[model samples]
Target chain A: MRPVFLIVLALISQASLADSPPLERQQALLELLHQDCGSCHGMTLQGGLGPALLPSALEGKSALMLTATILQGRPGTAMPPWSSLLTQQEAEWLVTQLKQPAPPQDANRH
Target chain B: MRNQNLNNFRYFLVCLMATVFLVSLPRAPLADVRGTGDLGLVVERTSGSLTAINSTTRRAVGKITGLGDLSHASLVYSPDERYAFVFGRDGALTKVDVLENKIVKRVEQAHNSVGGAISQDGRLIATSNYDPGGVRVFSADTLEKVADIKAEYGDGQLAKVVGLVDAPGQKFVFSLFEAGEIWTADLHDPKNPKIQKFKAGKEPYDALISPEGRYYIAGLFGEDGLALLDLWNSDAGIRKIVPEYAKNDPKLPVFKMPHLEGRALVGDYWFLPAVGHHEMLVIDRREWKVVRRIPLDGQPVFVIPRPDERQIWVNFALPDNDKLQVIDTRDLSVVQRLTPGKAVLHMEFTPKGQEVWVSARDDDQVLVYDTETFREMARIPAEKPSGIFFTARAHRLGL
Candidate 1:
């Protein structure tokens, strides 16, 4: 009975890990946030045609709401839906990253 | 005999010392003494640097660094093509001497700037600002503020300026994105400009002046048509053309805005990139009517014409940004489709249009191709490149 319970626990953990993107994919998504999304929103997310995505600007916004916006996009604006490219989990991950304080200047590789 | 040998040794020493002195002196000044006609600049967007390239040698001669926030940077050259007035997104106006490969003067002109233009006579430089929305003109040589024209609208509200271009008669034309108006500043007198305003359509996102500097056309983002103003006939006011081109079609999502520039006009037909659609709209310039719609691989970003106007090279927005297509002007058909690289940002033709240089930002390389044979000629290393401006633009109107 103990062996069977341990197998079930391991399976559940594996399923959860599979839901999240891999390490390499997370890096790629961060790059996309900086470059592709940066084209409209400033590279540092300070705002251009689009609004700033900095932590200060997004302080009141919920992570889930931001994720939904990323997935469905704002209609009638220049912001287009990124659902075709990003999954729900990935979009949520990006939102969390945006909500955090920007890294140090030297940390930006590019 | 010993005295004669000693004299010869002294002569040899003198020659060796002279050769060393000549070689040790700075060679940069001598090498930089060249005409600016063959020079160009590549905006390394990510690095906040400009790679000064030589079209004749097809090599990057020098890299000018320290210009801040070059993500959406653009520049116009002096009439002599020696100085490049770079407009940064951070509202920094930097005048760079391309020959000297350094910044002559830099001023944080505004909180944010979209682009800029130099006057027809090349004496004044005008920058279109996004933040604290207004147009500021400066002395091209001194970078000193000459005039300030705020884009004030209803109840003192400011509107961001876009698509600023230089016109023929020492004039500057630009569109107010939020206010839906077009303003022309006649800077015949550097300090005082005669400002003319016209009511345009819903949202004028970008604009371009005609090659002959006769007409100013602004593309509307809020509506289906474009606003055209005839500089030759100021009394005619602004006319909306192709009002029903996309009225019946469902609007698709636009990842990037289509750039409206001077090269869209090819002879009688004006080839323009339709917003939110994977198509190129070919309009009859004489009647200002949509004549044909050529389907494309993706939403066209830039519809650039080759120097001779025989072919038009196009790059698309995201999801199809890696692909580049060329259209035959005569047939109005897609002639060639090539996958140059990731995020193909901008393209520029040689002075005579024999070869074209394309910047692929994500790949960190600029690919040069032969226009006639459709062959890859060369590849230049760059850091997230965007705009490729050649000195030949100095002589052309509305570049």
Candidate 2:
């Protein structure tokens, strides 16, 4: 029964990932994560007023947990929640990008 | 004898080249550049320094350097509009000669500061500081320190000052960020000013005196309301308005502090950015009531109306920072939506309301638009330009 539950959970997560926003919207969200998020988290995500978002900094941190934090900002801090601007699935996708090796090319392009 | 002749010939050739080089130079001499401040313009490069442009010709005049930490710098023009007082993020107050495109005098008044205000009489300049938590007044001409009044609140704790502006009666008004109080200092006696104080809202981020210099409204960060003061009637005390604004509603976290200057008064109603929400809260200025809430593309950052009050333009915080919304004053509705490139930091309308200039930070360009046609007219390249200020701003009160 436990094995079956694990399989169902894996399938649900896959379905959510497949529901990612259209290419155009996904692209815009990536820009927001880099520039807007960079305003506090640092342009390069190495950390300034906010904590670093680099993969190295996010190493021991779980992707799901970071997604929750992105959707619901930490209270009593300057880190604002992006849930109003981003969908939960989109937030999850962004967390994945945040843990990637490098920021998107156009993030710094303009 | 032959070698001497050769040396003289070489010297003659060198002098000819030197004369040609000096003659080829284009910009006017420092002495000649004086008194042309009316023709001057400055675009603050967040990186550092200012690129001086001829406001009349729309051409880059020259670059003025050695200004420290321009990341959050603000400017105030002199009475003749011949000079600019630049308040740097590092608390450096620099008096720049607009005509000569040079910094005349610079003094590090505080460890850190946000911005400053010039006295109405143009006799003094005051800076609102973050570090050491106080304000310092200096003489406009000599750049000499006049007074250092600490923003002290309960239990002798010093507080950072914000929303500083010059009142009509030779007084400087500012609010304390930490202590949550408003204070006024009369510069009648420059060395020792008579200070007046009042308790205001919690975490008042910034304040703006009305265009007519009647009301001083400060938006709070710690709470959901504003502190309003009538300059004409100081004894009336500071009253709280827009109470419980977005308090019960599930809202997003405030990413950036909305400026005090963006509250646009379209006749009777003021369209202000609703903190942490995708809406511009409309309040009837007479009753101080939240009469309406106009939905926006994102968190509204800057709210500026045309000089004629025909249209009100707004920019947002993030993700939607690329979009701009314009509201018609006649019907009080969004008239146009503009995508002027990414990270639009600031905008300024023409003196006569012909065009509005917007700074696209990421693109490093100043996008100009024809207000009537609502069309992009020109794009002038700049170096990380954030603020595009006209000398005309000097004429306005509590600007």
Candidate 3:
């Protein structure tokens, strides 16, 4: 009975770990963005104090290109570099979230 | 065999019905028409965004975004009014539904297609891109590329293509800046438009042909004059330069700018913004000479004649005492000073000519002033607002 229980536990742990890497990174980056940058970037990142980062705004740019912009902000514009504020890996994760499609808004539908 | 004969007969009847339906019904219009009331247009250069405002209440009803690095976005309404094509900085073009104020599609290929000319029928749009040194053509419907014309600037080319004006039929006229050349293309067959070139001025910024499309006039920057070129005689290979206002007057101080601001064609005369002489250099096309110098102060960026032909609305960018100068075309005198604003770059008029849309760069807001009362009605905030065009009648024209 103990051996059988151990086998079942290992199977469940492996399945959970398979989904952990990207999901955990995405959640952490989103939390940091919400706590640190949401003051200007808006909660959903629709862009208020800062420019919009939704798919509509960053249409032609690729994820890697946008990540570079996050690390090294555009010059002569209000955007500032986040290289000092965040690690390169973290910045890449944040850009990936920004590139993702904006979730459909339920209350704002009207 | 008998059953097959009946099937063939039915098919022929259906084809006949379709042909009759197509032939009897009037031809469908080209583009969708958008607005009827006052439709406000603004280009936010820094953010690469555009907004369509309702002029009456001063509310932003429609929004267009993702236009790349839009420095000078020019809006053109389709004859049917359904769509408004915006030409942005670095040649980014986007089509918007003015009524919905939503971006329909964007053409990212024309990187330098800044400003362009749309055919009167709304069939073709000709854009002169910089880096590739050519004009790009796009279909009004799908925003798909239709043609490309090679018109690169030469070694001595001092001016860029300031603006493009469509002529009768499918001809497109491109006004070259320091190059002093008006490049014309026949776009009836856009895939291979016949190109023609004519020399005009030292640094011709904007050129306008007569309503009948006979004469072409370009404002020569810093030269204190306007150039008159006869397009009617293009087939004769006759190119004449009318530099009547070329000489600077000693009394007025020269306000040297890198480029000419704007030009207007009224009847047979061409009214060009004279930067050096502080006046509207009006040149008679027939005589090809400066008939009158309408005294103006600071630097004029735009001079739009009222539809009534009684007055002209002149907008300037310099923070000199006068920013909005209303010139009485009959006497060519400064009739009224509209507003005292810093760097009034461009002006657009309401459909009925009741209000003037003034883009104040220093203030980053669009000021709406009543033409009759000359009072500031409302100020719509924008970011580095550069160009404003009306889309009120765009939908009907299908532009």
Candidate 4:
């Protein structure tokens, strides 16, 4: 019974790990966030044509809702759907990153 | 002994003459002394540097670094074509001397700025800002604040300004993005500007002045039309052109907003990029009617004409960003297609328009091509370059 319980626990952990994007893909997503998204929402995510995505600006916003917006996109606006490029889990991860404080290193730094 | 002394005296006289001639001639401070007319600047966006290149030499002459946030940078040259005022995304306006290849003066004028323009006389420089939304004008020489025209509208709220361009009669014209209006600040009296406002279409994203500086057209992002203001006829108000050109078709996602500056006005037809569509709209400038819609591969970013106006070159947004298509003005058809490099950003032709320089950001190079033969002439190494502005832009009415 103990061996069976340990196998089930290992299976659950593996399933959760599969939900998150790999480290390499995360780096690419970050680049897209800074460069492509930065085209409209300033390079530092301070805002341009799009609104600011800083932690202060995104305060109290639902991460799930933001993830949905990222995947489905807002209609009648310049923000287009990224569902073709990003998965639900990946979109959620991007939202989590956006909600947190920006990293110390400059996005434009080579 | 007497002959030897005479020969030595003659040699001494020749040496004295040579020294006098060398001292009398004007001393050059630098080894390479050249005019700024043939020189241009390429904005190294990611690195925050400007690569000053000589179009005549087809090589980078110098790199001016330390201008902050050049991700969406643009520059305008002084009337003398010696100094270039670079506007950074972080709202820093840097005055760089192309001849000396250094920053002469830099001022952090706003929190976020888009682009700038120099006055007709080139005495004042005006920057369009997104944050604190207004147009700030400064003295071209000292970068001192000359006038600050706030884009206040609808219950005293500030709106972001875009498409700032210099018009005739010491005027600076720009479009209000949020307020959906166009304003002309007549700085004939720099301290006290006579502001004139015109109600334009919804979401005027960017604007461009005609080559003759008579028409100021703002491209609307929210609608399928453009706001046309005849600077020559100010009392007529704004007119909408090509309304509902895309009414039948669904709008596609625009990864990048199409830039309207330096648009192609070949002969009587005005070639413009249709937003959210892989097409170029040919409009008759005389009647302001859509003449033809040339289908393209992707959403067009810049539809610029070669100096000779024989051909129109176009670059696209993401997915098709690597491709560049050339259209023949005679038949208005896609004449040639070439994959220059990855993420092709901007292009600038030589003063006379013999060769064109294209910046490919991902490739980290600026490729030069011969206009007539359509062959690669040279490749310049750059660090994520974007805008390429030649000093010749100084002479053009609206660049």
DockQ-based class of model 2: incorrect
| DockQ of predictions, in order shown | 0.33, 0.16, 0.02, 0.35
Alpha carbon lDDT at B333, candidate 2:
87
Query: Candidates 1 and 3: which is better by DockQ?
Result: 1
Model number with the top TM-score: 4
| DockQ rank order | 4, 1, 2, 3
Per-model TM against the reference? 0.89, 0.77, 0.65, 0.90
Write the candidate numbers in order of decreasing TM-score: 4, 1, 2, 3
Q: What is the lDDT of residue A86 in candidate 3?
A: 64
DockQ, computed on Cα atoms, for candidate 3: 0.02
Chain A TM-score for each candidate, in the given order? 0.77, 0.77, 0.60, 0.77
lDDT string, candidate 1, B289-380, tens digits: 98899999999999989989999999999889999999998898889999999989898999899999999987988888999999998888
lDDT of each: 0.87, 0.78, 0.63, 0.87
lDDT of 4 by residue, A1-110 (tens): 89877865664354347566886777777777876788888777778878988889989999888998888778777788788778898898787677645342334367
lDDT of 1 by residue, A1-110 (tens): 89877865664354346556786777778778877787778777777778878889999999888998999888656678888889998997787667655421222345
- Candidate 1 vs candidate 3: the TM-score winner is 1
Return whichever of 3 and 4 wins on DockQ: 4
Worst 10 residues of 1 chain A by lDDT: A100-109
Give residue A21's lDDT in candidate 2 (0 to 100).
Answer: 76
